[model samples]
Target chain A: MIRTENLCKRYSRVEAVSDLNLDVRAGTVFGFVGENGAGKTTTMSILATLTQPTSGRAYVGGAEVTADAAAVRRQIGYMPDVFGVYDDLTVAEYLEFYGTAYGVTTPVIEARRAELLDMVRLTDKADAYVNTLSRGMQQRLGVARCLMHDPQVLILDEPASGLDPRSRIDMREIVKGLRERGKTVLISSHILPELADMCDEIGIIAHGKLVACAAVEVVAARANGQRQLAFDLLSGGQALAHAFRHERGVTDVLTCNETSVEILYSGSEEDQVALVRGVTLAGYPLKAVREVGASLEDLFLRLTEEPVLPSGA
Target chain B: MHNVLRGWVLHNPLLHKELRQRMRSGRTVLGLSMYLLIIGAVAFVFMYLNVQGQTLLLQPARTAELFTFLSYLQLALISFVTPGVAAGVISGERERQTLSVLLTTPLLPASVIFTKWVTSISFLSLLMIMTLPLYSIVFLFGGVAPSQVLAVFILQLITLGAIAGASIFWSTFIQRTGWSTVLSYATVGGIFLGAGVAGYLFDSLSTHMPDQGLWSMLSGICYTINPIYMQAALESSRGFFTPTFHNSLVESVFQTVKTHNLTSSGSWMFFMSVYVGGCLVLLGLCSWHLRPGTFAAAVRRFGRWLVR
Candidate 1:
């Protein structure tokens, strides 16, 4: 339902989104993971038809975002990162306004407004002023506003950001419900584990470029096959961590404590055994040597740390 | 076509929402009360000071004077209130961050601008209507005709519409409500008042005589748009109101060209067309830039063809 081809957005001298290619199939949740300034919001804005790309093309629901923006808007519901509301209007009035703006019939708007307010758990606050509601309630109201037209696609930028833990859980459940109802959602967050819990496929972006895109379990399985080693000693693990930087197949080193370090190693068993013996024989008082299970956090850290490649690479 | 008209005029969501919010506001109620009170007090005070316990009988000139004073007062108040009402229409939405979500709906940019314009002008219309009981003073004395009252209202509405349009343009051009309001006030003050001032300064500074062709035409325009001058003319024209205003367009244009100056009626027409019509044109340009339509696309294509 959403696709972009080499989408590039530039602001003066800075490239906000550089050659970003993305695809989200119908009826699936695609989580866009990136840190701040990693171009997640820019990409989402392009797909929402709010920002025109400097180069290349974006599409939502098979319509080009720029050329057929009205159609694209008709098909997709967009929730910006910041929750915006008309302060003086009541919750029901706010929803009614957007419904009429979207050309939804009055009957359908009332019916859907009731259903959506219930889904977002704000049915009781329907008559209350929007600004009087809590932040979480306002965020939920924003989601309800987008769904007023019963769109098939939803582009939510950082829907869970700045929410309390309970609010985050509530948002996750709402998104889960959306998926169950067969809506395509492209959600973005800088946090990976949050997306891991909800997304069917995850794309990790860094430096305005997408570095990795895969199904959740596929990325997790790749992490499972990773060869990382952890060490515990009496002291001076920092010095050995410095030494292991030159060690073969030791891709990256993380110093956990003064006496402990975790090494991302992809060497054969022979090299591993040799390294273990070398650490023990080096008079470091090695307490333990164990293989550390790789996680999505480790993979995300490793992927973001690497430099972006040239276009064709 | 019928449904579209109904939606725009009857079911316009933006207009309905704005009107509902503003009508429910305590400030609006307070403003209307204060406005009516001030106008009524000023009129009664004028009558008391001048009449000196005598009946208003045979006081046609005093009533006419009172009518013109009220018209000028209303014009000044409307001029001040218009920019404040309209300058925030678009930029406030942006500051609240609602404009982005609004654009992502099926609503056209034209509808948004039009509804905002109507919403604001309709409130001004309500204020004008509220002053009618006060205008009854003029009517009771039998100096002002019913048609003159309607004419005065129509003139005020047109002037206010033009000012509101300029405010909308500023609202669209600027992103923040604070600066948009500043520029909107500047536009009203500069266009209406500054035109007269600048024209006077030019006449003073120049060696050329005021009766010459271009200078006289330009000076005529300077007064036509000035509300004070238009209302002043409304007093004199109350006797005739230009019976020949229904003259053929060609004859009017020919007379304007032959005289090298605008007639009284020609002056108002010129003022209305230049201010209101010019605002409509510029506002259309701003809307097209905000939501580029087929005209822009076609222009780009034409440029490409020229390059080819």
Candidate 2:
């Protein structure tokens, strides 16, 4: 398990991470979602013990990161967003090198190296120079390297940041594999959907403050008390869209095409029913209507659209 | 003891990795061969001169000259190679983004520093050992005794340690490899320049009055402080050995070298103690600074101390 209480880090005039309170359970993946410079990497770096927070305490596996960094380090495996490899070393040697550095026993390192290489699917490139591997291969190799010590927790920062679609899917599967192995993972990424499918809980940060942290579905559904409704009309689409924009609960209307439009709806089910009934009674050719489910993307955009208040506020 | 030693070497993957990367390439072999070639050529040139002059009688002097020349050459090689070997070690790791990951492992900063320092010195130690046969040629043909040779080597080893400590310090303190290397060379150059100025001043002053002046005393101290100059004092030392070997290996080696006239004047022993202590402190500071926020932490402590 990993936890942070009021963690803050500042660099001279800039506050990188401010008053962040986080708790990750023992064997679940927690997705950290934020845009560029949203303190995601800064938080991960503090947890990974690469940087010391200016204030507050962080613990991994019951060991405080600063007071007992050695213990925390032993329990956690960390992967930075962009990493460099030893070009001179083969994949296996690179893994072996870190394994020995992590103080894994000889037999255990050998056995786990084999299993991890297989898990990350780098067994075939075991003898190939790391520099010769593609970016995706190297990312997979990083996963394998992180797992070499058989750590209980993994803190991955943008593990699929620059990967192709296929590689991202592959990375997702590897993370799924980690979940199956009962390892706690704290993953941060700019991809909302990537986190939505994999994370049990998601934390959305904005402007150095955490705006929301909840279950994946809960955060998606709590999008500023609003939802969207799509209206597919056979005729009078433009006129209906214009009329919908003036409706009491409809905040805005978007014309998707000549026959399809979406209206931002913020009202009760009775109100939505009344509006639809009115549209039908007015003799407009209404084909179909469906309420759009709020997604992480919508929630992310809503939360980040306005300047975020500090956590305490 | 056996298990501890085995664990120390076996558990040190950084050391093994560095050695593997360096040795697997043909570069180390090429460097060793080049080292042998240079020492050999110098010996051959001296041999040719001796034979052409038909001076078998001056063979003792020539052998002393050869030994001194080769040892200086060895010191120069160490001076030239140490910055290249050491100045990029920690900075290169940081540049490659490996230092953060390395720090996150259970390996202590001390361990990282020690491993890199040992790796650098071990290669130089190997180079010195490789040239031992050539050194043996100088030892056999000269009035130079075994203790004097040992003293010279002790000086060279300490010289290597001093240079390595300085270079590794710069490498850890500076962010870029190129800059660290330049500073490492600058540190070496600064020492040589200071000593050269002192030596020149001493020469100029000694030619005039019975008074040797401050530069004369400083010159003598620099001769001991600078290992390259210290070798000259060691070469002119006693031509034989009579060590009582009562203390430890290091202490006895110092004692054997202490029998020389330089130590009788107390300057060599004083400089050796201070220089070795300074090297250790430099290494310790390098290790301490490798931790995160150590600079800010140190600054805070210093501020608190000032307030107090």
Give a tens-digit lDDT track for model 1, residues A1-313.
8888998999999898999888889999999877788899999988887888999999888899887777898998999998578867999999999999888999999999999999999999999999899888998888898899999999999988899999998999999999998999999986677788889998888888887777876765464444668999899888889889998888889656678999888777798999999988888889999875457777777777878744322
| lDDT (Cα, tens digit) per residue for candidate 2, span B138-253 | 66666577777777787888878888888999999999999999999998886666665565466567667587566456556655575655665566555442322233742423
Instruction: Judging by DockQ against the true structure, name the best candidate.
Output: 1
Instruction: Quote the B-chain TM-score, candidate 2.
Output: 0.79
Task: Kindly report which residue pairs in candidate 1 clash with one another.
Answer: none
Q: Per-prediction count of colliding residue pairs?
A: 0, 0
Q: Write down the lDDT of every candidate, Cα atoms only.
A: 0.81, 0.81
Task: Name model 1 segments beyond 4 Å from true.
Answer: A220-293, A310-313, B1-3, B202-211, B238-263, B293-308
Clashing pairs in 2: none
